[model samples]
Target: MDTDLGYWIIPLAIIGGAIRVSTPFLFVSLGEALTERSGRINLGLEGTLVFGAMSGYAVAYLTGSPWLGVLAAALCGALFGLVHGVICSLPRVNDIAIGIAMMILGMGLAFYFGKPFVQPVAPDLPAISFGWWSDIPQVRAALEVNVLFLIGAGLAVLLWWMLRATRVGLTLRVVGDSTDAARAMGLRPALIRTCATAVGGAFAGVGGAYLSLYYPGSWNEGISSGQGLMAVALVIFARWNPLACFGAALLFGGAGALGPVLQSVGVSEGYYLFFAAPYVLTLGVLIATSSPKRAMTGAPGELSITK
Candidate 1:
């Protein structure tokens, strides 16, 4: 390949990778955004993600409709979130610990039910094509992106508007910023958190559904590879903004696909190093964004983690 061609190929690959890999991160990051905005962190989203994938694929296989599978995954994810919310509400039970426990439980349940779904060919999601205008094959290939990517972008904008300019968003922010203040205003913190967690879970489930129903339509032990966990980090990196989450997800998507792209081009010797790019970027962002002094001085007063 020409040197200039190689440079162009990288950008094209990045675009393709971003479109393909960001769906899961977008869903999970958005979900985590909602959960964190409620002053609770659902670290168990990893398990919720995998379980949702398994449940989505299994249900789609059984019902012959991918939409129903998406619904089933959302319901299952909501149930898990409910469990996490209820358990964490108990005195002396830390939300993080409960989240970890829920993660284990979700994974175990998924494995149990997913064993029978390892090989079934489920219905795949249809993509929307707008590539006819592109005369170049490479350009057309990039333009023919997944529909979920567009949906995710739309959701991010919608959520940002809702959070910044709506009553419900204000309530959630108040509750997240100060439980006592929310209670003073006669808003039940527990209720708000419960609702937020459930909504977040639903988003995560949809993300999972996208994984099994569209990207790679089959169940297996390795369907998801830490996309859920990275999404949690993504939320923080995005500064709890839904719109920012979209950009962050695309960045993560590019990082994730770098390994495979390099491998395809006969550069497989340091494959593991390429795979570490996303996590390293996440950590770097976290370090850059977090400051103990600033956190102590500026964090929401009722937020337990900062305290």
Candidate 2:
């Protein structure tokens, strides 16, 4: 509550919180980016995210191995993506509508099956300590980066590189830009999109694992909130770029942590409203930047989000 305490702790808390909060966003947005890059959009990732969280927690609880839980979550996510991709591959199917439906189905299944594990505790993912040099407790806490964020960061760099220089990247771009071109190249658009969605879903599942196995570190019906859904706007805001998605996710994480930072500094005035910061940021970005053409600035030409 001290004025001096406010200056230091607020920034540190916000930084740490941003790192913690953004992991989910990082993973989801990256996943969404991959899907979009393939000329397909899987809105169902929200469901995949939540379900991954639940399944990951359940597996870790049963097996006592967080890594196994993460793997399970990834597989679950891929399966969800696969289902969505297959359905959308059918002639005249709507991706957006299917995504919404998948979201509902995933959430419903999680809620129904997650009841038993709600009260049980699961082992959390590990963190890497970069705060050993910092004697200050707050500094130490702020510097304790989680393993997943680091992995996600590494994945972002790898994805960016692959997209720029790899043959697979060229294929994704070609399919996304024009199915006709993809067919001209003898690539199956439907197959590419389905695989991309599955991979994207796998990323979303990892994000879910982070939510349940770390940070919030628990299983509950509302654990994910709307992080999965937010990734869509995030993907657009980042212009479908993987590296940009990392920065955007951090920005969102900082926004989300703002309310808590204020409360920690003893600002009791309208504290609850601060919790809405992330959602507000999402809406503002979408409203200010999104257009009728593929939802934003750098969308894939074949993307049918607007149509």
Candidate 3:
């Protein structure tokens, strides 16, 4: 085995990893951020993510436009979130259990609809080129970043600003911190949570769309590998901050890329272990940050999971 010291490769790989892995987390984390901010936790986002992948791919294949597919996916996701939010708002229903049920339902629906799209060639999202300043082939290749990365970054900043500087953001935080307080302030907690869940679902759907339309086109049962679940953990690790979520997502993405990077270097002895890196990192972070005593401290007070 040739173990060459290609210093540039490491940086390139990091950049590529950030670009490739952050999209899904970006959407999921941001969506969760919104939901959590509104005093709710939609664990069914895993299903939303997968179902969105299928919906997006199928729509894009039929419409010949990846953007439309993304829109359709978002709509589908919103509908799913609506279902979750409405059901969870019931007097005796539990959000966590309902979320789990929704996840299974979403996955089943995706498989059922996605069966025909298993081998179809759908239109993919376009990438932004940043290789103009580079003359070297490696540099050029490294600079070939996806547009979704930029969009995710921009969204982080936008969300951060909105959360801190906007009245709507204030309302969301208030709702999360104390639904009763929000009611005292004459705000409708249920409405806010419902809207937040819908928005979050849309984001997850878009993320799923990215997986199907860009990173790996076409549809199959195994297109996703728990990226959706990891994104939920990432939201807590990120402390409900969209900007922090972006950084956390990049880290998770790097962990995910380790397997392929090692494989590229002809190291395959521990490929399966490498594949587990992202989940392990997620678990570690959850343990480090989670505490029963401080559970509702960091989490929104009204959130069912935190309670």
Number of the top-ranking candidate, with lDDT as the measure = 2
Which of candidates 2 and 3 reaches a greater lDDT?
2
Clashing pairs in model 1, backbone N/Cα/C closer than 3 A? none
Candidate 3 lDDT over residue span 154-226, tens digit each: 9989999999999999999999899778999999888888889989998999889989988866678998888
Question: Which 10-residue window in model 1 sums to the lowest lDDT?
Answer: 295-304
- Segments in model 2 whose C-alpha atoms lie over 4 Å from true places: 1-4, 279-296
Q: After best superposition, candidate 1 residue 277: deviation in angstroms?
A: 1.7
Provide the TM-score for each candidate, comma-separated. 0.92, 0.93, 0.92
Our model 3 lands, by Cα RMSD against the true structure, at 2.6
Instruction: Summarize candidate 2's per-residue lDDT along 16-53 as a digit string, tens digits.
Output: 88888999999999999999999998999899999999
At residue 190, candidate 2 shows an lDDT of: 98
Residue clash pairs of candidate 3 = none
- Whole-model lDDT per candidate: 0.84, 0.90, 0.85
